[model samples]
Target: MNAPNGHSWHPETGRLFRLVIDQLQCTMCTLTIHDTHHAEYDIVDMFNMPDYLANRLAIDIDKSIQIDAWIPEKSNQAVSFDYEGDDGQDRFCGLTYYCRADPTVLLALSVCWQDGSAPDEWRDRREAIDAWVDAHLRLLWRSHRDRGRVGSLEHTLNLFDFTVIVLAADGNILFANEQAHALLDVGDGLRRAGHSITATDFDDAVRLQTAIQHLSHSDEQTKSTDAGVATVLLLRRANARPLVASLARMPPTARGSAATVLHVIDPDGETRPLVGELCRAFGLTPTEATLAHHLVEGLTIDGAAQAMRIQRQTARAYLKQVFVKTDTHRQADLVRVILNGIVPIKASLSLPANGGNGSARSGAK
Candidate 1:
């Protein structure tokens, strides 16, 4: 299918990769396979990324970002990708490939490339690139659906630092990625120890289930107002460490279609600093500082405890201390203060959204 953009698909992967490297003004790129429980896709190899200083920008793959796509029958899980040990860098970039309703592979590509020398042409096609990537995911899903577990996408999705899920019209747990699996697995108590529940156990997951039901039953206008996205942080890893989660409802429909997407993220990197910074800046008690940090950073009190490797009660004490010290009336104020203090370094690229709407997918095929 011809994309709204003019570029034609390249049948060969090698040719497509090479063309992307040459035409897109990226310092370097590679292709690889990404597999997970819910979704499988190919990845744009970062082979060339290491060669260029620009590539070192960490993609916060651990951070979860889910967006309710305005497009029909689609939603996106934005995974944060980041370079480790370079957290202080002002500019950051990561790749998040989009997947479709069937949970089939979508385009696997990097996003927000921070390379300073990147050409205008590459930047100009941002929307087209998104569209193309979306198309790739759909095409790849179609190509591989029959193969099942035996086949995977030419691209890859990171189990860690990424949120993978099969979206339905009503936000059902169609499927999930490795990271999602590790996160959602809830072990039974000693008596029922062996038993476990996956993503369905999450508080946000249940909320999402409720929201989906409401959206599916409600009319469009009611659903639109009622339907919204939320961010939730869950406990991840075999140890069940705390991570952030986001749940968003898209425009509603009665077909049980997903109007929203859910994302889970690990904010361990920003946790300590965020906490310590609040304490130092506000003279908060250590407990207050710690509690303030986690709460503001989007962790639940329980999640903060698990993250801090402390007991929930102990975490609660710290939270109270934080409240008293900060002299803040609400948690929202605390979050606002800290977020405001954290500066954002942004880079912009003009894409051919208006006239030059070239299709990057056409080249991929």
Candidate 2:
């Protein structure tokens, strides 16, 4: 089973936590606080709650439950509270367990009843529930920690507008970000072949494989020299400009079995920086920022004007203002400044919709 939010849900592990909730005849919610001081946390999982209530709790968690008042001095400290919903009609009795093993991981086990009054049996079984959590705390912590780590990495990779892929020493695909998967699924230039990524053209495939092998088998000195420098290759496509691929070896600490990290940028694809980001970074108006974005995306002044549906002279005026604000006189300088600036580092919220292509899979492929 999957979580309502599409997170991986392990029924067996969930059942372990659900056992106590069943015994107590109440709904259960599990939360993990990555940073308690700054109130950075997320609901790891929940069980036995109606979809409406769960959604409401996820959105208005801070307003509904106050956990800042009581910081558990030690691990396995269970704190209980009674709180009403925003409308004041729906009431809940919950117990939050804080396990400060890492000073960041707080396990909140909310046992809720809707009627404002919890049964006497719940009070009597409180110690038993705490004992059960203590007995299985390590297992529970590992499950949540691993899930959060994977989810965070996937999200971070998806934020990039370009394609990112991780390859093993032998060129097996270990992981691919959302953009990479989409690009591969399109089968324009690069596509997944068995467990490895392959280019459509013979020469491109040879060059790509050679680059991956070089990075994979590089000595310590060569690796150090190549650090921060990528081996650039161009993958030939059927219609568009060749996709530019930058290959670099992963750091020793992070490599594990993965040898190379490949970042592919499709020149003809929509790789425009956000207009709002450009405006804030360069202190330009929305129109000026939009014009600057087009320039950075490889559109000439006339081309940009045509795309923006404005007069050529008006576009030139916007470009002049952009140059003054961005401290760049030439178009090349403008593109370089914007590309190397903080604009590209900003994560794009909008993602391409997944297609029906059958070849977009991650993990050992």
Candidate 3:
């Protein structure tokens, strides 16, 4: 399905790893895949970024980067290319390549070695490593692209009046919506450091980072217990209002990486977007969706009906269908289900008026 922002939530493309690369950079990281993020740990401190990447917009296969002592040469035979470490001061095992999603600059990684030389045995394993990196590179780029489409300012997360940050296990800030960027932009509260998220308050930073680190290292036994019960943290910015964040380990929708999702909410922010998601999730028609939204706002059925410009009987009819479809007889249970349910990316919430097969099909009523 799709969200109102037109980003699709589907089995093939999950929301979990959307900002994985960004998250990996927030902490000291080691990767078996394209290590483009390591560019932040670049030599020159002025821009504090690898000039090749810090200035570029995308990395296409046709173009290449000039690392100090090395040059990029695409290998039609292999999925990787080589780079000299620190302008040839040291030798490293690794290559750089870009993905279809972002082609202006290449991604990088280095298999370390002392004395700047690959061991004799390492030569035998080079082809295998290349194959692995090649296999995973494009997929990672796709994840970033998909995430940008859904979680970016043009999408649903930003339209709502809440701050959303997605992090990797290592506490790297992978993706932050528009609301989050504003908070980070002002120096005093929160901000982006080279490949990391930083805060003016040491305790808040430590607390959040620790939670994210914990989520990153969580085992199966602990993950189940931590799923719905999120860790809450208060980020007291320098001159801004304190931000209350609900931090949780978002279990992966598919296999591979999962991330820590931080939802920074305003004490009085409206939940209309969430309600819109709820309506689309259970096939609620426009009127029914409006009714459900009103209920979520703490209105009674009569009040909701009156507010939606419908008769109490019609509202009751819609409510009964909602109960049957949602498998809840009580209003509280219905509300809980909607609030707690996964916010799926779904198609449009459009449904016919007067509630037809919509109770069985879509939510807009």
Candidate 4:
């Protein structure tokens, strides 16, 4: 690797700094470094030229090393790596650093150049700068590979209102953010046995499992370029109201092909309003509609009455009417009828006329 402007390598600021000050004039320079893990990078530190340049040079021991610009594509083309000036086309030269670690990190530095300066002056040092940057990346990657620590993820979760939970592929709870603890009925005492979360019944557990599976499959097929998908599932508790979980794929790219993030968003508002709307459209009275809606929501008659704030006798009477009007003889039958009746107007139009029956006549040719 060649050193910038024939100066020795300086760990304080890297080789790009000296080259910019010696070979170029009247320009501002910026240097930044970061780590890359989980297919992403986070910035670590930065420095501004001139002020930091003196500090960098003072610490250097070697005279100067010259390096060749490494072109990842289109080789032998001497292109000046612009540190800081305007290139007349409004494009400026910049350097980006990324570390390959468990969570990944990124750094970006911009060097603004003096206007109307010839490109050849900076081109001379391009090889040297590229070599230094490549070397820095190697060092950063090795450091992360050896060190295992959760740096920003712990404190960062507090900044968001949503609760973050990490779940293993086998439905075991790994960790939970602070918000996760407060929002759900989970804490150190209740979280024993590795089952931090509790659902109302088997159905709720199945729903969560299905959601996780769907999210995992979606994340895999979508590739890294597109925005990841969030899986939505209703997690209901016996004592507490249900929560809407927005499960997503988290960083470090799920080592075992699983969703890393399980965001449990509390469910807000009533769940039966849409069912009530359909009941009203089907000419059901408010009481009958309430019964029908709750039934569709998997509530028993007793449950529906409590929800409707009505006596069991009154609720039963309304449910009987709902069954009769909807031509259903049982609660399950009534639910099926009500759901089938609520087809959107556009969808109803798509149905074949005359109950899908076709008229046929005998004919002789």
**lDDT winner:** 2
lDDT of 4 by residue, 250-347 (tens): 54354644544777654443435445555655557766777787788788999999999999998988877666566668998887766665532222
Q: Name the Cα RMSD for model 2.
A: 11.4
Stretches of candidate 1 off by over 4 Å are 1-166, 170-179, 185-208, 229-246, 252-256, 263-270, 277-336, 339-365
Worst 10 residues of 4 by lDDT: 58-67
Q: Pick the winner on lDDT between candidates 3 and 4.
A: 3
- Best-first order by lDDT: 2, 3, 4, 1
Tens digits of per-residue lDDT for model 3 on 78-171? 2333334456563333223323224333343322333434345544455544544544555555765676776555577755556788887666
Kindly state the number of residue pairs that clash in model 3. Answer: 28
lDDT of 2 at 80: 70
Q: Whole-model lDDT, candidate 1?
A: 0.46
The better candidate by TM-score, 1 or 3, is 3
Cα lDDT tens digits, model 1, 44-87, are 34434442322232111211112222222344443434443244
Best by TM-score: 2
Clashes per candidate, residues 3 or more apart or on different chains: 57, 0, 28, 27
Please give the lDDT score at residue 106 for candidate 3.
39
RMSD of 4: 16.2
In model 2, which runs have C-alpha deviations exceeding 4 angstroms? 1-136, 219-228, 253-258, 271-319, 342-365
For all candidates in order, the CA lDDT equals 0.46, 0.69, 0.55, 0.50
Worst 10 residues of 1 by lDDT: 188-197
- The runs of at least 3 residues in candidate 3 whose Cα sits more than 4 Å from the true structure, single-residue gaps closed, are 1-179, 186-230, 235-244, 247-274, 277-281, 309-314, 342-365
Candidate 3 C-alpha error for residue 286, in Å = 2.2
